[model samples]
Target chain A: MKEIVVISGKGGTGKTSVMGSFSYLGKSDLVIADCDVDAADLHMLLGPDYQRSEDYYSGELAILDQDKCINCGACLSVCQFDGIQSENGTFRIEAMNCEGCGYCQRVCPTNAIQMETQKVGEWYTSSSKVGSTMVHAKLGVGAENSGRLVAQVKNEARRHAKKEGKEIILIDGSPGIGCAVNSALSGADYVVFVTEPSVSGIHDLKRVTELVKGFSIRSGCIINKCDLNSQMLDELITFMADAGIEHIASIPYDETFTAAMLEGKTLVEYDKGPASQVLIKSWEKIKQFAETEGCLK
Target chain B: MKIAIASGKGGTGKTTLATSLSSHLSETQDVVLVDLDVEEPNSRLFIRGDQTHSQSICKQVPEWTGDCSLCGQCQEICNFNAVIKVGTQIMLFPELCHSCRACSELCPESALPLKPRKIGMLNQIQAGNLIFVESRLEIGEQQAVPLISQTKDYIDNHFDESYIIIYDSPPGTSCPVIEASKDADFVILVTEPTPFGLYDLKLAVEVMRKMKKDFGVVVNRDGLGNNDVLDYCDMETIPVLARISNDRRIAELYAAGELIFSTIPEFKEQLLLLERSLELSTVVDPV
Candidate 1:
């Protein structure tokens, strides 16, 4: 099975929106995964009928036993985060501040602190209205271990794809060059790097492309809002050419793309406008590119 | 006063609001802009200045000195999964390491030595009328929270109490956002008006409430999608600090890497209003 992850280093560059459209445009047997656990919103487009919800545990957190606590402040001294809070003469471990370093448990004098696996997030398997089984997750606000969560979401997507005999997994990836993005792009057959024509977008595109190249992944490019700056588009083309990355498609800036999202529908479903046609054409190019890598065969 | 501009999702115009307000406020008051969005810091794109200061951030990672047997005590004690021992080989993954110092302390042979590894860089960019503190993590580095924390520490170390500090944070309600927003007097969450906006904004709201930080929402791209964001803010009784209308002229300015206050003369009035509302207030229950 092959997985094509759609990611953008810059935020709001239409990674999720493109993935939403792909959910409708792609083959019927596609298992989709939303790997943006930190701010997952792909389900906003798909409106999945969640079938199962499970707690995700990664990393460990120290819980202080009030009974065993001698109020010695030993854990407080070792904590670099100041995660230990002294409240009304009793100490408590601030979960957000705790980095799960396990130093607090080790520093406890009376064994007052116990290490427990933290439920940092939740994952779900849902059937989307677009007829694809979706695997998505929500990382707890301010929670770490997002890389582990993204891995779980992808693993679940692959398992679902195997059970249903689906040959492809479409992942909606997160922004930035963080561990979560690494997790989404890890072991993927192809990566579709989406970006826009702007200074920040170009700046981030360079960094993310460098990241993808390090993984040795075959990647394609989709430039959204290419009409914003012809100069930037030209720059992007030259950069992609020099980097040996595939410049698959460039879609012009259109208000309908946002309008379609406002209506809770994909561009093609909302209106087969010029922009929608461009996206459809781009999807075709992506399929051909993936096929070239023996992904379809 | 320290005000942090944060968003639950990426590309929600945190830099737009922060830079606009910083530029406007610098007209009269002392101001410092801290770009804590280490991974993809773009605030530098909006502002121009000289490099006043620069520093490389280093973390302590346990490096084996190859002195003795690989008894695997270091690997067993590491919570970050940064150390792995295969056969006689002891490999240290610096990227995954959190530098908790437990592994090095627990090593039986005292073979593990704390080695300083460069993770990112910190800069004090001299923008017009203010100092802009920015952090840029090295590409392929996984841990941003440590780098973000050091950046915050740098701000505190040389804090000028007279200046109004504005922190422009990375998107997402993750560890990076938390590290940036941890000590802010007030957090101004910049969000767009859409389903995705509301969806992520709610997560951001949950994070702020958990931290008990003084926060209010500023609905950006007001007319782009729908009233879901505003309606949710009203329903939650959370203070709706400001609404930045989505005018094509503004979009053009932003696309061209220009600040709204500089190009659009009339928009300065609204930005000033946002600047005024940033004063610390008693927490209004958003119940």
Candidate 2:
């Protein structure tokens, strides 16, 4: 199966909006996964009916037993992560700050600290309204190991795609060039970047594209709000050309985007506006590119 | 007072609000703006200034010195899978290491030792009284929290509490956002007025409440989407700090990396009101 991940280095560039339209267009042939576990919103548009969910545990947390604890502060001293909190004569472990490195447990003089596996999030397999298997996850608040959860979601999506004989695995990736984005891009066949014609957009695109180039993935760019700044648009076009990235589509700024989002619909499904038409044309190009480029070995 | 401007959703005007607010405050008072979104820091795009300083930031990870006794203790103790023993060779993956020092300390033969690996760069710029500090993660680096934490430490070492510090935090309700906002005196949650906006806003609110942080909301693109976000904030009794109207002119200025409060009179007025509200909030909950 071919995997195509849509990501924007900067947030609010319409990554999900584009993914929603693509999911609708790809239908049963696609196994969709939303790897933006931090603030996943693709499900809001796809209307997935969750079929199964599994608690995902990746890291460990140090739990201090106050009964066995001595006030020596050894665990506090060894912890690189400020996980140990000391007040008066008492010591506590802050779960949020704990890196699950188990250093505190090894350093505890009284053996007061114990390492426990932490359930950082949950992943779900669902059938979306667009008739495709959807795999997504919700990372716990203030939780670490989001990259692992993204990897889990992608693996689940791949398993489903292979079992169901799906041709494509279309993924909606997160907004930053961090661990989660790295996990989502692993083993992907094609990468589609959804960006805007803005200073921040171009700046972030440059950074993320640099990261992607390290993987040598075949990629394309979709410029949303292309009409907002003519000068910025030219800059973006020039950058794409210089970077050897194909400019797949240039969508004008249209209110139909928010309008469709408000109604819980994708831009293409909502109305045939100018932006929708451009995206429809671009979808064809993405399919052709994905097929011609061949799958990653 | 230290204020963090954050949003759960990307492109929700966090940088716009942060840069504009810092620029406005710098007209009279010294302001410190730190962009904690190390993975994709964009505040530098809008808040240009003279380069004052730059430095490469590194995180500590364990490195094998090839003196292993083949005890296999380091691999067993490592929780991040950053270290592994392969056929008489020990491999270390610096990108995956959390630098917790467990593997290094637990190694029986002292084969693993903590070493610094460059993960990002920190730059300081000066625009009049506004000090803009931005950290950008190096390409192929998987983590952002270490850079963010180091940047905060740099800010604490350089800037005193007399200046108003603003953090342009990364989007999401995850560890990076938590690390950025955890030490702030107050947090300003920026959001647009859409279903996705409202959904992510609630997640952000839950995170702030869990952190027990005092926060308010500023709705950007006010008229672009429905009133669900405003209504949710109202129901939650969270203060609506400001409302930046959905204007094409504002979008154009933002697209061109221009500050709205500096050019738009109405936006300037809104920002002044926001400043007043911030003053009232800070006074009531003084640090």
Candidate 3:
């Protein structure tokens, strides 16, 4: 199966909106994976009828036994995160502050602290109105290990694809060149970058492009709000040409896209306006490229 | 007072507000506009300053020693999966490593030692009353919180208490945002009135509540989005700090890299009102 991830290094460049349109307009049977686990928004557009849910444990949590009291403060001294708190008489560990480093566990003389695998997030498999399977996740608010959650969602999507005989997977990835974005990049046959025409947008696109290059992944760039600043658009085009990256689409700044999002639907489903029409053409271009690419594993 | 400009959703004018606020506030107050969004720092482009100083930030990753025996103990102890036994050679993913030193500290055979790796750089630019401190993370680095932590720590250690820091945070409710806002005295969340903005704003509010951080909201591009953000803030009793009118001039000025207050004269009155609100709010948690 072929996997195409839609990502923008800068947030609110409309990655999810573009991904939603792609999912709606695509002809092949596929799955939608919302790898933007930090703030998964594609599910809001897809309205997936959740079929299965599973707990995800990316790291360990240290639990201390109160009965085995050794007030020696050995655990406190070795902890680098300053997670331990002294309340009245007993020492307690703040779960949020702890990175599960195991220093406190190793330093505990009386074996009071033991590490337990922590469930930091949850993933779901569901059926969406677009006639495709959807794999998504929710990382606990203020949670760590979002990278792991993203990986699990992708794996599950791949597994479900194999089971159901799907041909492609459309993933809505998160922002930043961080752990989560790296997880989204792994094992993807194609990556579609949706970027804006602002300075920060172009700068981030360059950074994320380098990251995609390091992974040796075939990629494409789609410029959203191309009319915002034509000079930036020209610079972006030159940069893409210099980097030898394919420029797939240039979407005009249209209110129809936002109106569609407000109504909780993809642009294609809401209205066939200029933005939606351009996206449809973009999908056709992506389909032609994805079919001819030799890098698909 | 450290005022953080953050929004759960991106492109909500965090950098725009931060840069303009810095330039305006510097007219009368001491301000250090620190761009804490390490992944993509952009305030440097909008503002002018002298390249005063820069320092490279480093993190230690585990390196296999020559006399290494693959006991797998380091792999067993590490929670972040930084260490793994790959045949006779233990492979390390430096980007995934948190540099907590647990794997090296717990290595019984002393074969796995800590090695320094450059992750990012901290930079300072002096623009008169406004000193811009920006952190730029290396392109391939996955972990941004450590660099963010160090950058904020540098601010805390070097800057005087009287300077008001306008910290611009990365978008989302994950570790980076948490790490950036940890030391903030007051947080000003900027949001539009769209559904996407409202949903993410609620999440940011929930996170701020959990962290026990005093925060208010600023509605940007007011007429473009619906009244949902304002309605949500009203229902939750969260104070609405400022509302920037939906004007093409704002977008045009932003595109041209012009300060919002300088180009649009009306923005100053609203900015002053915001300054007043911040002053009133900071009294309870005074410096």
Most accurate candidate by lDDT: 2
Q: Candidate 3, residue A149: CA error in Å? A: 0.7
Residue-by-residue lDDT tens digits, candidate 3, A1-297: 888889998887889889999988863488889999987888778889889998887677778898895777888777766678777768988877787888888879899998888777789999988888899988877888888789889999999899989988888899888889999999888889999887888888988888888888788889988888888889999998888778998988777777888899999999978888889899988877777666412
lDDT of each: 0.86, 0.90, 0.85
- Scored by DockQ, the top model is 2
lDDT of 1 by residue, B209-249 (tens): 99999899988887888888888988999898888887767
> Which runs of model 1 end up more than 4 angstroms from their true locations?
A86-90, A294-297, B280-287
B140-200 per-residue lDDT for model 3 (tens digits): 8988888988888899898888888889998889889988887789999999888888888
Clashing pairs in 2: A11-B10, A11-B11, A12-B10
The TM-score, computed over Cα atoms with residue i paired to residue i, of candidate 2 is: 0.97
User: Mind giving the per-residue lDDT tens digits that candidate 1 earns over A1-297?
Assistant: 888899999998888888889888874769999998999988877878889999998888888889999998888887877779998878999887888888888878799898999788999999998888999988988888799899999999999999999988999989999899988989988899889878888889999988888787888888988888777788888988887778888888777877888878887789888878878988888777776663211
Ranking of candidates on DockQ, top first = 2, 1, 3
Q: Rank the candidates by lDDT, best first.
A: 2, 1, 3
> TM-score of the A chain in candidate 1?
0.94
